[model samples]
Target: MYANPAATNRFTVNAFLNNDQFACVDGYRLEDTVTEVTTPTNQPLPFVFNATDDHAAADALRTLSHSEPGDEPGQKWPAEIRSLNIGDVVQVTAPDGTVTHLAVDTVGYIEIETVGAAARPAVHPHTHA
Candidate 1:
């Protein structure tokens, strides 16, 4: 079996049978029993976003910090982040509870698919899961 490294929660396998009788080498019927197996390694860890800013920016950040359903099943955004403007400072909380302060040096926006077609300020991080 071969698994895709980028897949977060799924498995894929290819198998070949030796004979057309659907029998195991030991003469047991393949469909008569169930076999269970575990993955050799755990799945990849997910990215966490914890940002804080002043009133308006913080509200915008929180509003955009969400995942929208994709066309494919089980598909979703890996992190809760959005574009940010220059000079905006935000405090991010790590998974271990350690907090780090980050300053936005670039401008970013999140597009909204509305009748008027509007965009809002966002905080884009360097990395996402």
Candidate 2:
């Protein structure tokens, strides 16, 4: 994500079926989940919703952060996140039903979705006895 940090919510992040140097750095995919944003002060950010999408949700924040919004996302949305801020807490759910508590941490010049605060290992295929 250092090159562009695309699709990140003013964040450098991504996820896929396979792990990479950047995507899923936190070990959880940002889709198929509902993410809650809060500040160090403990205020939970409300869903940034519109007809086309909820900008604050993981799906939009993860994808739209990389691409531009469509023609009619309208005026309710703000560029407030010109990217996310440090100490902004994000609670994201993984596909296997785990919540990863991430706090925005800036490393050098790049922003990282700090991992292991309360993160769970990503689910993998396993054999059953």
Tell me the spans in candidate 1 whose CA falls farther than 4 Å from its real position.
1-83, 107-129
Using lDDT as the measure, the top candidate is: 2
Can you list the residue pairs that collide in candidate 2?
7-66, 10-83, 14-24
Model 1, position 62, has a per-residue lDDT of 26
Put down candidate 1 lDDT per residue, 63-94, tens digits, no spaces: 33244432123333234333223333333333
**Once superposed on the true structure, which residue ranges of model 2 sit more than 4 Å away at CA?**
1-82, 108-129
CA lDDT of 27 in candidate 2?
A: 33
Looking at candidate 2, the ten consecutive residues that score lowest on lDDT are 11-20
Candidate 2 matches the true fold with a TM-score of 0.28
Residue-level lDDT of model 2, residues 45-74, one tens digit each, is 333322221223434443343445622233
Per-model TM-score, in order, reads 0.22, 0.28
lDDT of 1 at 22: 32
